[model samples]
Target: MSFTEPMGRQRADDYRSAMVSSDPLMDVAAGLDAEVAQYFLVSARCGCFMQAARSLNVRPTQLRKHLALLEEQLQRTLFRFQGSALTLSRDGQLFHAQLIAMAHERKLPVIEQPLIRLAVAQSILHDILGRDLVALLRRNASVRLEIISLDSDLSLQAVSADVVVWLASTESPLPGPSFAVSEPERLAPLEYLPHIAKRYSRVTARPVSLDDLADFLLVQWQHERPVESFRPWHDIVDQRLAGVVQLHSYELMLEMIRCSACIGLLPGYMGRFDRGLIALPGLFDQSMQRQVWMAVKRESAGCEQTRMIVDLIRNTFHERREWFDT
Candidate 1:
């Protein structure tokens, strides 16, 4: 219709109808929600509402609502329902492809991630969690990691870590100023330290007794070695009186133990994984083993970053269960 046409009711109605159908900005004005798109994709991947909800750590009802709202906005049914089964419709597949393409093309808006403050000793960080932690940081661009290097005697509350990983024994357990603690994940034992000599053919046989261990210097990770704190195997150390050699990190201690005839307290996981190290038959009592504890402040227990880190830690432990039993 030309603008020079006479003003009439039929002409106005036609103009309004054309504007509504042809407007390029209508879809843009409706607002594309990334979260809704994520929900749809997760549900499709999981192939069920319940499983998708569990995967995304959200309520199934919430996911349903997101899918319903997304369908309403797009004016299309995205899922085909057959009794209890759920499958993506043709339109849903197309939408999924579009959303994934947008993300791959870097067209999606970036979401901010919460900063995570983690406190752990340098030794534990180096020997066990170093690789996993590095991978988490590299994979997650949103997260800002503020790692607090803690000393053995440093108080947990003093550092105020959102999450803290500490080495604790069954006898000592986790200290006061309570945080939600994960199940004790046992470290690989230092029993294998004495066997390093045998593995390297430096010794004819494994050390048979505590007296035999006295022939070698007792090396300990500087961050975890007990000074004033009570060690579980009090008699093992007190009776033998092996001179202690403290190293700054487990890697250095392992290197020292491997190179020389030194007996160090090495993590069981580390010992088991390295073919060059072996566990002495009668040196260590399993009851005296130490464990790795992941603790989080009660206040930040629900924080996304804290939860993600905790899950990653648990998953890492699960993957290395042969070495780091939970």
Candidate 2:
């Protein structure tokens, strides 16, 4: 359960010898056990036994024992521990690479598709990435995607998601050293414009001032309101709006606005999809803008599947630059 000392020169020699044994029978017969290989791979990716245990749904002591047994069988120290922190040794990295290759080779000939986990805000998923993801799946039947709608308090590290797309303001802080994160790719800020269904616009007189919003029902997206930065408008209209209906899903909010006599704020890009919606004039304030960003886990950054998803996301924002513009 304890690994206080670092791998020394003698241990390094033993690792190299085990990796390239002179006996061909020893090499072939002593290939890594499947279950133990899984333990080491997960531990290396997680950077610590505790986290690896949590990920594998096993006790830390059990995981440590399995790793220790694997090291004994190979005559190599695969991991080093300083205090409570665990890291893979250089030999471990080489072995890990070999294991990954073996895994990929085993999945050949249409057995299992590559799975990429994407964690994103509900609004973004509903309004933007949903359609794009559908298109991606249709084009590439070999790719499988697991889309997780980010909760207010969800941690990307906890979910083991490969990529994350979220509003910058609501992003979770970077995880600890045990988890590796790639540099974030910042996207253009999205502009939210007030939109009313044509049916609602027909019955109400459209005024040219901010005060006009006070007369209509304000349908607010749960995450975007109360537009606190735009105090002039927030104070005069949003806070004093006669009726407010808060919704969690953008799709539902759009339907509610389209069918009822209410005003809703939606991303400008959405206007292209719903022709029945009309933008309310004189309410496009700068405070309605929100920045968005995407990040990938370092472990998954080099994966081709992950790269494809990242490219798709970046392209989605790029193609809609005009919709996000202020």
Note the Cα lDDT for every prediction shown.
0.62, 0.68
Clashing pairs in 1: 188-267, 188-268, 188-269, 189-268
- For every candidate, C-alpha RMSD to the true structure in Å: 11.8, 15.8
lDDT of 2 at 12: 60
Candidate 2: which stretches are off by over 4 Å? 1-111, 151-159, 169-179, 202-204, 225-242, 284-286
Give, for candidate 2, the lowest lDDT window spanning 10 residues. 169-178
What would the TM-scores of all predictions be?
0.55, 0.57
* Candidate 1 TM-score over all chains jointly: 0.55
- Per-residue lDDT over 147-250 for candidate 2, one digit per residue giving the tens place of the 0 to 100 score: 99863333443566888876644233333112556877677676566788876676457645676777777776665443353344344444753587878767
In model 1, which range of ten residues has the least summed lDDT?
Answer: 186-195
Could you tell me which residue pairs clash in candidate 2? none
For 273-307, candidate 1 gives per-residue lDDT tens digits of 56777656556454345546666777788897798
